[model samples]
Target: MKETYEEKINRRLKVKQRIIEVAAGREKADLVIKNATYLNVFSNEFLQGDIAVANGLIAGIGEYEGEKEIDVNGKIVLPGFIDAHIHLESAMVTPSEFAKAVISHGTTTVITDPHEIANVMGLNGIDYMIESTQNLPVDVYFMLPSCVPATAFDESGAGLGYKDIDSYFEHKKVLGLAEMMNYVGVINGDGDVVSKIIASQAHHKKIDGHAPELSGNDLNAYIAAGVYSDHECSTFENALEKLRKGQFIMIREGTAAHNLSALMPLLTKQYSDRCMFATDDKHPSDLLNGGHIDYIVKQALKNGADPIVTLKAATHNAARYFLLNNKGAIAPGYLADIVVADNFADFNVEMVFKRGKLIFDGEVKEFDAPSVDETLVEKCHNTFNLDEVTPNSFKVDGKLGLIGLVGGELLTRNLGFADKTDVENDILKIACVERHKNTNHIGVGYVKGYSLKSGAVATSVAHDSHNIITIGCSDTDIAVAVNAIRKAKGGIAVVENGEVKALLELPVAGLMSEEKLETVNEKLEKAKAEAYRLGADKSIDPFMTLSFLSLPVIPSLRITTKGVFDVEKCELLKDEMSV
Candidate 1:
């Protein structure tokens, strides 16, 4: 008879038991740390005990003898945190490399959405992520990408039908379908949308949602379709409505959206069971400095959330919601993934353990990181049919309808049109180019409120599809911006006075960098400062704002490299300059 997956794992764990057995069995075992207190988030209590490990699981919870016992008499031991929702690709590093930054912060497990990569390369992208993360010290699980290309109406790099969802279910690491972004499709009874949800259910997987402005009956209908969670809730009332409707509201903090202060009030001990924390799309700088899920835990506690409640949100609640039964709590048979933190206020980590092995003791280790290839970075094509784009083709006249940008948010603020003014009206032009196929489909439109006095900003980090987006003061600047993007392979860049003003290189995937975390962060900070130097005075994170303008699913108004999209109406806005 063949052994089951559980049995196979147990057999291997038993062989790795010698070191742990010695630590727990003797009155001074192989490795013993004496005089430590444990914070049990499960029972909401602090217990005075020494935890013992054997065979990579929590073999004993009380005091024991170890071969080597160190006095850690003043430390606090807490279970390692789990990132309920995140996009690893957004970190701008391969999975193994990203581990080196987050592991020291005591993050032991992460539930990631490969949807960003899926949108650019589809199943192939997801396969690469799965293959790359399997053997790391951190436990990285996945959700089948819920919205490739985000929505059906727009032109994206890849699209998945029923076949793709079925294939994803075969991967044991796949937990569920990722966020269902096309809420309108679910409400309107689109067959393709319904099929994806049904397929997930058939595989015994939970469905995630991305309903930005849905509420009332429409929201209820989407929940009826089986999407149980959403990370796009912006307001308290909306979050309440969704929670009441049976959809778990993921309180999000990201490079673009900051919702912690607004949502913290709702996570009191009374309502804490249903809430969870997620960094939907954080940049590398924030992740490296402020911490990953650890940041969310501190912010929640400081804002009046009970420490136990916040821990549950970051651990158990998310694990249960995602149906990760073997994780979320520290128990006899759990994955032995745990963290020891300094205190409730600072939420500092003293050590991190995963699968019964010490990955970090709050600092660098001698463990070898898995080697990565340059293929994922080089995989994205930068070739565009420049032959079809003339200098005249980049300009548009008359009173032009424009997509408006709101600083500090992913959703755009709608601004109608420029009153038949010249290019001096600050009615900058925005374009999306198809870089994957060298398809010369460049969608052109006017954007208001950027406050860009004189230069053009271009980025390959366009949302969902990862196409190149350029918004600028003049056609000449626009041309220069795209050319620069091609020259660097890919990333965000600014062109002014026939010169490059600033850039953050994303040589990996033409959307990320293979550079060190500190190096990438420094470059991003410089680029942000340079954006203002080049005349974007309205927003702190202007380049990130520029990227979301191309996301077609969020709502109100958006533009893709393909065309101007009206997400509320789910159609292309008419070409008339008048709204």
Candidate 2:
């Protein structure tokens, strides 16, 4: 029998008394940590004290008695760091797996948008993710996907409107709206966008922002539509302007979108309070090696940021922005979700406690992650529906506009040139195959600076549309890579000379792995190695870099299932162009 909300409330009231008793010294705290130097995010200073925990909440601080005690020897203890915004799907792993990877890195809180999954499996997918993450050491919150298909131009598996997201608005774990990617609709006061915002506001939920490169009045217009936080500011001017306009700046350092270094300089004392740290879409390999939010903090510090300010942005600022009460503070009555780090500069997580229960003990061998619910996987049709694929399908003629790859960022430069076969010049064929409706639609073009001297990479993890996108020097290798992904149902593949070199299968609606985080990382690393062997430069993940060419939301140039897109003008290119 499922317990009602009233029953849960009554049970919580009973625990409330126990917590009060523990705080008053009448009852024993379940556990206590003594001699720890507090991060004290609330006061912006360090304090030395013992923290008392009972009923998964901070019962008291200073001179509290407990049944069990852990000594820290004055190590720095702060609220477990919070990742202000993230897309769990980008980790290419399930929610439980993503939690396992980041919990050890001291990220106790994550605000995620499951729009990618929703685009495939619809509302069922969102529900599956919600059920999948319950009772974990890390606290994962949801920002209901405001734009499932992203825009009208692309064909996604699902098209969610207000009805789809309305129910999740009041869910305690569902914070508010995800990034409102449809800034065009918001600016133009489109009814659909306005109604979605109204639904979130009616429920009093925080709206996350995703306006990349919008400046001045346009940015203000987007903000005025009720997006309170942004993780897509890719430039210093945009980041500062967003902060100036009262939109919380989420400095994102993700797998494809690396905006931290560019925006870190904006972490000035005067504006630091409005800033927060978020890895919008980090891959598992990067998460395992680079160390999640701690890695972001370390990078910000290396970029000459103020230590205290940086730490605040990493923790308190996010908590306050999301209104995660009883979090982001080392004070009485706050959640006893703390991270014991050896030092602030390195941010080496020694131990982590969620609700006073030790989750990560700084020992990898002894760790056990929360079990995932297999039933929560909203099974859908395999996302490979290409009617027929051939080497000839990838051929493009005339003046070609190529998405020029940047070394450390996602923003692409549009390079125009005549189509020709030149391996040295790095003019390679890029295609976005229609996967949703199987309209026999393919957007074929060429891209420069990809550095794929030979072979090809294909992925069904293409952004927003989640189409089958492939890039290759030769049509046969591209076909092989794409065929391998199709055989896997949905996945990423690297092919050379008509043979699959590396493949990572993402069978779950073509976007994420259902396997363990470690497994996904191994597969991704192997694929990345194969990409490098194919002459893909070490500067980027060729698979992911190719995947983003289909995301029309970013800027400059991109492709959708319909055709090649000039994002600035929102124009779709046709069959003819100057060569």
Candidate 3:
């Protein structure tokens, strides 16, 4: 049975009455923390008070009595952290499992783009994510994927134009349009892309950005189209230029791209307000070992940044950016999402409160599991549609255009042309196998800096399209690795001597695992170790680096199911390569 509109109003009125009374100090609060030093984000100062909570909201932040009370005499209480931008699929675990991992580390709210899964399962994938993350300790919000296939050169499982996603703006948790990766579409006035931007603006929603090295009139045209933020800033000069142009910069520090160190100069009183924190993509090991938003905050503080300013960047700045009015503060009428830590130096979390209820006290407490739609689950569980691949599936005919890896960066260099796989020079064969519709259209090419001496590494976690991508010394090993991933439904596989060495299965839409974070991390560690032993690059995460090879939006050159693509020209290589 559902409550009528009138009944719903009455219920809300009753709750509001109690909140007003508690805030006025005429009635007892549901919970209170006494004698605590907390940051006042509004004033940018430290204050002491007895914080009161009632009906899952901060009733008051001054002297007040409560039915239940706890004292934190020396700890610093701050508003919970918010990740401005992230792809939940990058964690390689289910939403519930990802929530548990971050909540304990002080992340209470996250704005995620489901583009990874959306590229593989379409709208059904977005539906699956929303349904499966409900009623959790951490408040998960959605930024509907703005670029499903990302660009024209790639083939994704589905394509979402403005018409496909306009209705989602009305969803309670949906924030705005996600990263507009196709800056070309926006600048050149592509009808479908412009319509999506227009729709987001029509609803007065924030549109995220993904423009790298875009400047001058080209960048102005992009901003004029109404995109609000960007997380791809890898240099201080680039970030400052965008910030000057009125775009909020998200200082991204994730598994593959570490921009925080370079952009630390932005964490000042002059520029900190227009910035926020984001981990665009983080693997399981990085999440469990380093931390989440908490890691970024700690690193900032250690590097001599003002503690209050850093906290504001992690909390209030993001909340205000996404227009989450009731969050990112500790005051009357605000959501009671808070974190208590011993001090700023260590930033060790001692307790966490979500909506006025204690959820983590050194260890995470048990909570109700999220309810997922079984229909969507059934559809997402079986996304692989390719047939068995053979050695012939990976054979390239002539001279190749190689994708050269840039260590610790997502940018790649186009390493001109090569006649053959130069084993001594660390150049090897790379292939992208179309698995979505079983087209059996394999795009074969060569890569320069993978450094894999013998065995091949393969994954179904290819960017945007989630195809089967593998790199190896010989056609036999690449074929073996690709078939192993197909055999596991979808996963990462390593092959040496025509034998599968290690595997980590990601069966959910070939994007994430339903396993616990610990389980996933353990398996990933073993797989990474095997990859390194077989001579993969030690400076970068081999699997994560390989996943980006097919993303045509990045720069210079890329590979797709079609063939080697020149990103600058936006065309498949013809006379440039001996295909």
Question: Cα lDDT of all candidates, in order?
Answer: 0.75, 0.83, 0.91
TM-score of each: 0.91, 0.95, 0.98
- Write model 3 residue lDDT over 1-579, tens digit each, in one string: 899999999999999999999999999999999998988999999999999999999999899899999999999999999999999999999999999899888999999999999999999999999998899899999998988898877888899999999999999989999999999999999998889989988888899999988889999999889989999999999999899999999999999899999999999999999999999998998888899999999999999999988999999999999999999988889999999989987889889999999999988999877888889989988898989988987776667678889999889888887656777999898889998998888887788889998989999999988998888998899999999888788889998999998999999998889889999998889899999999998999999999988988888778888877888777786635334
Selected candidate, larger TM-score, 2 vs 3: 3
lDDT by residue for model 1 (1-579), tens: 999999999988775565455444643333344565766767777677666655555656677765455456777666777787888877776677688888888888888988877777777778768877887888888988877768865566688887876878868888888888888889988898889899999988888888887898999899998899988988888888888778787888777788888787668776778888888776777877888888888888788787778888888788888887767776555556777787887778778877757778867465565544556434644322234344565765654457776656677755765533234565778888777667677877788767677878888888878788888777777887787777777788887876788777776556667677778788777777777876675554777777778888887788775677888878777666444
What residue runs in model 2 are displaced by over 4 Å at the alpha carbon?
1-10, 364-381, 574-579
- Each prediction's RMSD over C-alphas, in Å, is 3.1, 2.2, 1.2
Query: If ranked by lDDT, best first, what sequence of candidates would result?
Result: 3, 2, 1
Once model 1 is optimally superposed onto the true structure by TM-score, how far is the C-alpha of residue 550 displaced, in angstroms? 0.8
In terms of lDDT, the best-performing candidate is 3
Candidate 1 residue spans exceeding 4 A from truth: 1-33, 68-70, 371-390, 419-426, 577-579
Give the winner by TM-score: 3
| 10 residues in a row with least lDDT, candidate 1 | 380-389
TM-score, model 1 to reference: 0.91
Instruction: Count the clashes in each prediction.
Output: 14, 3, 0
lDDT of each residue in 54-97, candidate 2, tens digit only = 98899888887789999998588888899888888898887778
